[model samples]
Target: MNALPRRRPNPLSCLAGSLLLTAMVSSAAQAAPSQQLIDAAKQEGMLTTIALPHSWCGYGEVIAGFEKKYGIKVNELNPNAGSGDELQAIKANKGNTGPQAPDVIDVGLSFGPVAKQDGLLQPYKVSTWDSIPDDAKDAEGYWYGDYYGVLAMGVNRDIYPESPQSFADLNASEYTNGVALAGDPRTGNSVMMTVYAAGIANGGKAGADALNAGIAYFKQLKDKGILVPVNGTAQNIAQGTTPIYFDWDYNLLAMRDKLDGNPPIDVVVPSDAVVAGVYVQGISAYAPHPNAAKLWMEYLYSDEGQLGWLKGYCHPIRFNDMVERDVVPQALLDRLPPAENYRKAIFPTLKAQSEAKTAVADNWAREMGVQ
Candidate 1:
């Protein structure tokens, strides 16, 4: 979310504004799916999807759940690929009816409009379309946000008694040679967002200027030997090699529980700046199984599907709506980090994120004078 203003209306506040809207839309949205659509989807039998990592967003179970519900097979492709690769897949397989072609894509929000402009995407609004915030989706249903996550500090509590509450805390001499990114900023969304979030904390805004300032800040960390070059991982954090890692809140919290006290880590959404990053979903214009792709969209925006993402710690686009309606289970809400942190989170526009991504890629290493 290197959220420009960060998309937030606490669960309670959302009700005051959304309750009327929700009531107006509920009747139409609750209508059952026409048998014709289901029949067509069944006839297609398969839906090819791309760039969905099982561990990243509880996708392993999501896929299994979808398959179980529909008897349709989901053929996953290049689970580790990026948003750019997802677009390339659509371009390269335009006329191909093979399994290699993706029926649907879940990519960075920025790529949605570009894909639409490129004529690579098809439009299909889900049953719960109104629940998706207008700003997070296109007017024509070309693409819509599925879920979002905020970046946070993952501190190995075994090494440090307290977590760093803000970016400035990283400068503490005790944190020397301890900080690292979840992955390389030049190549990864989460990594680039970490830089963007740091820049905001350092007083830069949500666009390119903030990105350049972020790059400069990282250079300072490097010069002081405070920010190490290695990519952060659960195993390395457990090993205490990357004691202070900047990464998504969901990952750090998940890893903390998985580690089970061997190395307790504090996943702190820094007090100074909170950035929300959202990923969007779209169907391929040339999809071999158009009905199936549309069916997948319907399922994803449904309560079951949204909950699947929420289970994985992601904030589903319909989360506040569900919260207002009391549909989210208390146990699930209990598992997440504080809601107050998300209140202050900024959700940067796709333009801001695109500019930030480019700035980080073009200047991160060059500005630091690193080869």
Candidate 2:
């Protein structure tokens, strides 16, 4: 009789309970990432790698900030590989590489085309795309420049107390046997770009023919025995081994911090003939973490990201809004000589660059005897 009294089972109630349990398990499985996971990898903390040839221009700060914000550590490798070497490394490790291909690359403007042609770049239309100057990036979205450096003279004050003020001054007899260069046209893209820049500083495309003047300028220095084929190096500038060197303004500003006493170095943005050359960044086509890479690209071109260059004495290619909002500090701005100095900086079209390169090499060999 007691057993029969307990047999008041509700079939509907048991079915409802079964359905509720199933629903609860499904919801648990589909639950969104917790704050912790989001903190660890906003999109995905997978991993990001960059090939940065330039020394850390306070980039460490940028990395630290990004890591803290996204909960992902950024791995930056500044291999000594120049433009050629960097490309080769990527090509060599294309398939059998690590988790990510060189996710990001920073090279001279000339390398952008080289990389693009090799099919090494991934295209992404960044949020800041419109802000970038038309001439500074690929309209199709292959690469974008985050910072730029002007072709200027790096003068060692200890050696050349009276630093040359213009490119014209550099060619004077006094600078003979004193001006240093990394390489002639043989393997130096910077040298080549500088020649092109000189042409622009002299007069944009109309100035294209004027690049010959750069070779002539070098010829004078070589004749005076002042042309010391010393590539840009601290040893050359610090020991007064070579009093003058031609390079992007960033290097000169950087040397000020790299060498002890920096030897009272002076960087001049030749008001008359300075050309601005850009350092470009691109995402690898085979990026393992394409999503993360895209996000990183966006961050780099953002107001916060580009302004980080100020810490390294590099100028932001975009983010003029930050300057307008005073988001960047004055001290950092001071490190940059002046944007107007680059107003006349020449940027050759891709087609013109091809012609210009050959022209520069031929002229340098005959005039500067670089060969």
Candidate 3:
């Protein structure tokens, strides 16, 4: 369906690709949260979350629903903080039992293991833990995948009437001084993954090889003056400065709705290379409200919580389970970008992401002139 009026392209095409799920097996009825857990959380009184901007993954409504249901205050800190910042906050406030310390964190998949290994996380398996994909969670329950977003581009139609079809299309001079990433490629997982996708599109293998290829592609863009050093944000998109901004599909979808087609925005998951990024959720080791933190996890892993994320265009860790049970709302399913685009999308292994992180952090500045 058309995204808006007469000429506007759908922000997302109806997805047609199979979700690479190994746990599409059927399951019994869901186990609702235990009353004991809910009571304990209420006694603790508050849950502090970090790096959860409402627009990121339908978090605004989810948080509100939790607070309303349990009457537990959710003290949000640094709405714009990145995964690194969340980890830093946890370390810095290990001794302080105050609002500054985060009780829960939603971070890149790679950060989950790091945080657990660093003694910054505590394990508490949700009741529906069995439904969560094995690859998306820690066996010991220290961390778990909350939701995932596919790498996609947000194109401003005001500047270029036609949308770029693939990563290679961005190399055209027409996008000169316009190509950007929502995050800094040198340190941001999303941006790094974008590079990975581009690299794969340019004929690099997945993981380290793709990252190298991506770097080479960027170099080409840099030589052509088609790449911009600026971090693309919603404001920048509206301003028409960064006309072609590569970012998570959820983020771009939110921007599309927010913009309401003012200048028009197209969220396209490039056909050449499709990559999905999963963000994990963990309870901070130093959480002052441990019970509250546990309760928060229970709420999130529950169908209600997973559906909350789906409403925001995020594919929850329990997506396969939900779909198998025929629980996902058809309306939401219809809005997803066509699955054919995601046919080749690969969820990079932790090893791949780690290697990419190292490669980009070490070489971005020296080779591309910016970190």
Question: For this target, which candidate reaches the highest TM-score against the unseen true structure?
Answer: 3
Give lDDT for model 1.
Answer: 0.81
Q: For model 1, what is the error of residue 295's alpha carbon versus the real structure, in angstroms, after optimal superposition?
A: 1.3
Screening candidate 2 with a backbone cut-off below 3 angstroms (N, C-alpha, C), the clashing residue pairs are 176-226, 177-225, 177-226, 177-227, 178-226, 182-231
Which window of 10 residues has the lowest lDDT sum in candidate 3?
1-10
- Candidate 2, residues 211-317, lDDT tens digits: the string is 66556555666787878877756668778777777776766777777775658888787766645556778877776556666666666766677777767777666
TM-score, cand. 2 vs. native: 0.75
Off by over 4 Å in 3: 1-17, 24-29
| Candidate 3 per-residue lDDT over residues 253-357, each given as its tens digit | 988998998979999999887788888999998999999999888888888998999888888777767777778889989977676766766777788787777
Pick by TM-score: 1 or 3, better one: 3
Local distance difference test values of all predictions, in order: 0.81, 0.62, 0.82
What's the TM-score of each model vs. the native?
Answer: 0.87, 0.75, 0.91
Ranking by TM-score: 3, 1, 2
